[model samples]
Target chain A: MHVSFQVQAGDFSNAGKVSSTVKGILKQLNLGPAHIKRIIVALYEAEVNVVAHSYGGTITCEVEPESVDIMVCDTGPGIPDLDLAMTEGWSTATPEVREMGFGAGMGLANIRKNTDRLAIDTGEDKPTRIHMCFDLADGATHA
Target chain B: MTLRDVVQIVDGTVLCGDDNLGREVHLGFASDLMSDVLTLLADDILLITGLSNNQAIRTAEMSDILQILFVRNKRPTKTMLDLAKEHGITIITTPYSMFRSSGLLFSKGLQPVY
Candidate 1:
């Protein structure tokens, strides 16, 4: 099955809607609880990143019998330093974002922790694309 | 501990999910940062936080947390309560601070998720 959702910039109120919908779908598929949790957590962090950082984005999810693939693409002032952005405590969120209990800089780390395979396409003044894959079969990849 | 015991220990009022007060939580995680909360991988966690907002409820929903203990008397908005209800997450509010609430729960045998 395949599905896509639009994410609005600074739309904290509706940030998790995509993840929630995907979670419901996964539940109906009878995926393992652990797999569902990890997938949802990663998808949520990715969704929030677009809402909190980029101008806006689209999240697309493709589910197969053996794995799930999610791609998040956002119009952006993309990350100039991928390594720094990946650091656990580094963030560029504004004060307002901080007030909302986000911007602790764990977003990408959480995504990395939960996904089996990940890729990113980003740069200054360009859109950022995050691609994440999770194995649905043996669940051996989870740490 | 069951959520009922947690409510008694913290002198909390159930903001939502009163019917779920009997639900048991095995671990407690206290944080105001939603990102930190997202990093947690455990199940049956009672998210204790002062950040009472839609994002906190959303975080709990994504994490599969069934209960949230809002400290420092931080009452959740209607939107937050509604979101929690839709997800079947129990919400409780306490007058104590985060430190005090966690300490109280810990003293009463609520294990930490570390």
Candidate 2:
């Protein structure tokens, strides 16, 4: 089964809703706990980026018995410094996002750590698209 | 230590999963930051937090945390409690602040996952 969702920017109130839904689906599909975990972490970080940076965008997950393909697309002010943005402590989150217990700049790293494969496309005003692959063979590739 | 030990140490009110108090929690992650919780790695851990929301349950779900201890009397919404129930995660609330709760747990030998 496949599921797609729109992730709105600054919608911190419901940021994790999409990822949570995806997780439930994976569980019902009988995916291994390891695979489900990677999918959860990757999709969650991507969702956070959507709300923290983009003006809103979409998160589409193509779920199959073999693997789950997740793509997060955002159309907001693009990252000017990809290198800096990837740093652990780098953050552009608002005070409110921080107050809600987020924005420590660990999203991308967490995604990379959890996922089996990762792809990125970005530029100034150019929507950032994050493509992540999680194989059903126990996504146990954590740091 | 056991979930029961954590409850007693923090003076927490059990919200759900009373039957599983015998469950054990080998580690603890004390952060309201969902991001940190997501990235943290541990097994049989009890998550202690100040953030009372559905996301807290979501984090617990992803991390395989069996229990959630909300410090400072942060009452989770009905929706949050229901979500935790679905995940089989025990929820507890306490008047103790985050620091005090965590300190007590740590003193009792529940170290951070990191």
| Winning model by DockQ | 1
Per-residue alpha-carbon lDDT of candidate 2 for residues A12-122, written as tens digits (9 for 90 to 100)? 767788988887887787776767776788888788788877888998988765677888888867887777888888888888778767789888878888888898888
lDDT winner: 1
Compute the lDDT of residue B82 as modeled in candidate 2.
83
Identify the runs in model 1 with alpha carbons over 4 angstroms from their true place: A139-143
The residue ranges of model 2 lying beyond 4 angstroms of the native Cα positions read A137-143
Chain B TM-score in each of the candidates: 0.97, 0.95
Report model 1's TM-score to 2 decimal places. 0.96
- Give lDDT per model, in order: 0.90, 0.82
Q: Write the per-residue lDDT of candidate 1 for residues B35-87, one digit (tens) a residue.
A: 88888888789999998778899889888899999998898998899899999
Error of 2 at A118 (Å): 1.4
lDDT of 2 at A70: 89
